[model samples]
Target: MELTVTPAALDCFRQEWAFGDGEHIRVFVRYITEGDPPFAFGITRDTPSDAALTTVAGSLTFFMERKDVWFLQGNRLTIDCLGEDIVFQLL
Candidate 1:
């Protein structure tokens, strides 16, 4: 699986999530629908497992469950922090 995140998105994530050493971003598929985009994504703090796929972009470490790879492959994600709301976009 491959993914890309924008600088603006990275900054937004940095401002929102504080990471301890060995901790990283975990992307999970929350829900899937018949509607547009078809899936809902969420972020949580976690450490990678042996089966997890990991990637580093800038100062961010991202981990995705191996089972999720087929779903997230080739995805581009954008994040924006608006006051207390964090917006996530998949392109």
Candidate 2:
């Protein structure tokens, strides 16, 4: 698995979330049966309990816990901004 945060996303995190140096950002998967995709990606400010993968962009660190790694195996996950909202893409 790989993770990438676009420049726009990094800026959005800094400006909107007010994230500072060494802050941890968690990437997670949640099931929502009502949604088209069934499963959705979520981002939050959190510390790692059992990080399976981690990457740093700018001053912030983004990570996915061991339990969530199965959702993203062999994929590149990208985080970006669409207008004012955060979007996730797998490539």
Candidate 3:
């Protein structure tokens, strides 16, 4: 439900999404579910938000306010700025 983002990840996010727009990030998440009828889930930002982030899973979509956006390795993560230690909880 939570992950600590790395510094390297933060930089990449800055380049790809934050390079031109000071207002938003062109980010999304993908999820794969195993079942007889396998399913794939993806959540792309529909509205520009400097304060909110969300993703889709199963029958629900989770959302929280974004405090900071950072990247790690080959991935990106947004932190709950309202929390301590850049906590990101996906629920």
Query: Model 3 segments beyond 4 Å from truth?
Result: 1-5, 16-18, 26-29, 35-91
Better of 1 and 2 by lDDT: 2
| lDDT per residue as tens, model 3, 10-87 | 444444434223323234333345764343222233444553545432222334335322222334344333222223
Task: Quote model 3's TM-score.
Answer: 0.27
Instruction: Report the Cα lDDT for candidate 3.
Output: 0.36
The per-residue C-alpha lDDT of model 1 at residue 11 equals 64
Single out the weakest 10-residue window by summed lDDT for candidate 2: 32-41
Please report, in order, the local distance difference test score of every candidate based on alpha carbons: 0.66, 0.92, 0.36
User: Tens-digit lDDT track for model 2 on 16-60?
Assistant: 879899999999999979868788889899999999989999989
RMSD of 1: 3.2
The residue pairs found clashing in candidate 2 are none
Q: By TM-score, is 1 or 3 better?
A: 1
User: Compared with the true structure, what per-residue lDDT tens digits does model 1 show for residues 8-75?
Assistant: 65666666565444457887777677898787777888767744566676767877787666665676
